[model samples]
Target: MTRHLIYLSIMAAFTACGDGGKAPVQQDTVIAATGGPDTLNRMVLIPGGSFSMGADDSTGMPDEYPKHTVRVDSFWMDEHEVTNREFAAFVAATGYVTTAEKPISKEELMASLPPGSPEPDSSMLAAGALVFTPPHHRVPLNDVSQWWSFIAGASWRHPEGPGSDIKGREDHPVTQVSYLDAQAYAQWAGKRLPTEAEWEYAARGGLSNQLYPWGSEALTTGVAKANTWNGHFPYDTTTTDGFTATAPVKSYRPNGYQLYDMAGNVWEWVSDLYDVNYYAQVGNGTANPAGPAKGYDPEDPGQQKHVIRGGSYMCSDEYCRGYRVSARMKTTPESGLANLGFRCVRSVANHGQ
Candidate 1:
């Protein structure tokens, strides 16, 4: 298979459906105890308001352009990204298996590849996910493959491949989870992923037309603002934020809505099908736009992608400035990287308490 097909096949493996019966543990109780406050208490109510969405500065990518006015209805959102403890509780209560834990099927691999592409070796089709392996020396940022490796047996439980474990990092944001996995947890918790607009609105934290969730302050100024790479990209890291990877939730102050880690820690998965040109198509003063019906990425056109926001510990000014509030990134729904995770939101009308 071609290089693109190889990438697609590996990503497709991450989209496999999970299977297991619900366990005896009460879902509500389990969710309640998984870090933060109990059920409704943990969710902060964001006041409904209007804000300009997308990048308003020169740092924005093409997809973050055509800044438009968006109004979102008030909703309750988690105080922070879902943690390992919370995810573990969800798994314990539901016996759910994440996509990364599932073995790849040849049929699934073939579906993403070209019609007559040769089949990959079975040895390459193991249960695993991508891990960010920083190089000892700086490398070109253009080639992402230089730092990402598909390691077998890598999952949320083992974030850095086989030997790694969550262990004492229960409070840290759960990573290596696919969109489906996140959606599953949201559903079981009687919540749902935030729309791209709702996420940006909540991220903005009542701030209007600002660069970051905390306003237009430079990330490098003052104390460490978020868990981002403090040195050269893909190599040196000063750990100026006191973390080389995902940090424990609430390591820093929260945004205006009292939400933590909205700018960094891990890239948050939003409930929006990614379209490179979606912003151009959006009408001004759109109310609660849910995103396009289909997903498209010119780089990987055949692969359906979803929008991920907030950036991550790996984000740096030299490379990805994803920590910016209006910044946007896309990844295949099935693909889960070490820096990706999610949180949930609940609507006022459907507040299942």
Candidate 2:
């Protein structure tokens, strides 16, 4: 993610599939709601099944190639991405401090920077995270610095920077959350992040072989099903889906599983450590695959990476089509950005189902 590059370069910054073509008659319907003890968690029961896990579509990025079959056990997933209000409740209960709220440590700085690099200025060591700042004019997309800035005091509470606050956006998906921060919230709630396989399966909403959770429909048509960039991406956006940035978590229709915001709104943090080649190594029809034991990103080999599913509002047909179900992206576990957020999942084992 470009959002993490600038932050990590200075502070040790950071960090799907399918279908046919139709929604299965039975599977497309949401699983019957169970009044389990975790019902208050507001989770949707995803009755799992086998599905292809990567992009067979040529438009997909290289990492999404070699589509493969995978099986994931049924699990309960948050109905939507974790929102500011929900995260606030977690913070109030646990007094948990997010990674973005903590200043960079000397040890972490030294490990990330090149051995010969000079010591960083004290001012750059403040507590903050990355915030998106669109350039006034068109700029080369290759250099993301033109559109991203690392700001001090830019944590989940201050998604846009020092003066910005999430005050009126309580129902919007929480942003600027690092992987550890999301994991902490999950642990506190007795939940865990979903595995990439589980995530893709859920996102499909029982629709097999479709290009999106919504089926084979083109993204450019109809009442915008998800929040994605409607114009020239980084340079411009029409906000056609009624959001220039993160929208309220359920701003659009739910997927077959009754899961909202599965295609866009924000990129979601999942539990799996990323590996471009892991799909190739796993045998077909593999059940309950947890992803590679370790993480690796060819682009940033030295940094440990985790998979982030779905796409954010910044994605557009002309620039990034990451909103696609099979698309994959990774970032440093510690990197936080205004466009990244997450939801939690709990295995069926947790409640003895």
Candidate 3:
């Protein structure tokens, strides 16, 4: 099962870069307001501050350990995850194509596989993004492939595949977006993806050493917090938060910094390239750390991945406590999953503010 996950990750990396018919061209037009009135209307100014960046408790993953002090300059952050409506505007204006929309190349696919790996059938090589399909019965948590399927023709427009559409869910956070897709959107919007340190700082809001964006309270405790699985993972969701999948942005209360959906709804992409040993190498009092120059994941050494924070609706204490503020996850930059999305940020200087 674990091997299957690694193979899928590698395949996604190459498949996402597959060439579609469109020729690559740069867009000179900037659609977003550059430090104009609309800037504050859409983004919040996070004050500069210092805080402990990682987890020190038992909940911390090996990569999140060796909690270190970090500092960041003030920046402007999107109020919530990027929405389908916003993404559609970018696509319509820029005529941009997302990774999942491209076709897979056999050469790229073969290179991604392990040595002597069997060539995938033509049908299996069809371009698509991974979708989370829950099982009818309880399944072992060890094998994630049981719930995740690479469905052909699945893209941001058709989130659930062929027949699905965004339609009235314009306010919902856009899914099936690869890191490259997010980067393109940011470039068009005159902003950039947040650094891992910036993301954690903003997610922490004004609080410090907290387990969640809201506080130390358990996800299931008190009133329903962020959107998360209820009953069990992979199967049987009680919908305690009134959502079984991605919820509309701002469905829950905002954090101290007035950032919405900073904990769940969907995992957000940060600018940092992932490195399992990054935290250990980070010295104390590091300011505006941009993360390691390259990504290194021992499990999938061949695949370059980036850090993704803010777990999605599928997160739960039962199987994956990814919703925790300090929790971390990584995937190939080109891998677009139904549970993944991103937001943008701008440095104060970049914003010309």
Runs in model 2 lying further than 4 Å from the true structure: 2-4, 7-41
> How many clashes in each structure?
0, 12, 0
Worst 10 residues of 1 by lDDT: 28-37
- Predicted candidate 1 versus true structure: per-residue lDDT over 52-162, tens digit per residue: 898978778999989998888999899999888888877876777777877778777767665776666675478888888889997778767777777888888899988
> What are the clashing pairs of model 3?
none
lDDT of 3 by residue, 1-353 (tens): 12225455433323456322234432422233123223323889999989998984787789898899999999999998988878866776567788887876777777766677766667656767778889999988876767877778888888888778787787789999888889888887889999999999999988989989988887877888899888878789989899999999999999999999988899999999999999999999999999999889988787778899999899888877788888899987778889899999998988853
Report every candidate's CA lDDT.
0.82, 0.78, 0.81
Candidate topping lDDT: 1
Q: How accurate is candidate 1 locally (lDDT)?
A: 0.82
| Candidate order by decreasing TM-score | 3, 1, 2
Worst 10 residues of 3 by lDDT: 28-37
In order of appearance, the predictions have TM-scores of: 0.91, 0.89, 0.91
